[model samples]
Target: MADDIHTTREPDGTTHTTTVVDRDPKRGGGAGITLLVVAALAIAAFLGFQFLGNEKAETGAVTEAAQKVGDAAQDVGDAAQEAVK
Candidate 1:
């Protein structure tokens, strides 16, 4: 920068100098924060997809249907035994 500077004292008692530096600490903060937020959102989305994405509902429905069929069969068998008695 034009204002940024470097200086040295010479053996002849002369001083050599350069411009002063201009610094802004907040310059990259916004971009860093944005990146952090994006990363967090990506992680959350991945976790959500991992946990919520599956065929469990279909499997559960099939299992429940099978259980109902088994119960119906047991009821029919019991009725037949009673008739025999």
Candidate 2:
């Protein structure tokens, strides 16, 4: 069953057949390779999500920081004007 069986017919009423058989099935390598590929893809997906989530959080923090900076600048300008009076 492990070996491939093939049969062919020739033009002049001739037949050809080929069969190869293995006493034992070759094992191992295939399943390991498949598992490694699946693991690699899973890790890639997880890291991609983590990076995107962190990027979104960092952008929000930057926006908040910018608003705080604007408020502080306004307070400084108000103090300087009061000193001139």
Candidate 3:
């Protein structure tokens, strides 16, 4: 009489008696795509805050701000011309 058993040899010169299981390839790719989309949305929100926050400085304040900017530029130009002399 013989015993009821089975065995198998793998490709790497190894013997085993087990079953192999396979997994889907899309699971990992889906996770990577989800992370990328979340990161993009976060960056867009940060930039939107920076740009929109400046628009609410004050009502009817554009002329005063522009004049101040022009005066500062003129001062800088005078200093540069003096340094060159």
lDDT tens digits by residue: candidate 2, 1-85: 4887788999998999999785775787999999999999999999999999999999999999999999999999999999999
TM-score of each: 0.45, 0.56, 0.40
lDDT of 3 by residue, 1-85 (tens): 3344457888998997754444444556888899999999999999999777776555337878988999999999999999999
Q: Predictions ranked by TM-score, top down? A: 2, 1, 3
How big is the RMSD of model 2? 8.0
- In terms of TM-score, which candidate is strongest? 2
| Model 1 lDDT tens row, 1-85 | 2365688899999999977767555576888899999999999999888766656777788999999999999999999999999
Best-to-worst lDDT order: 2, 1, 3
Model 3, runs deviating above 4 Å: 1-26, 58-60, 63-85
Tell me, by lDDT, which candidate is best.
2
lDDT of each: 0.86, 0.94, 0.80
TM-score of 3: 0.40
RMSD versus native structure for model 1: 4.8
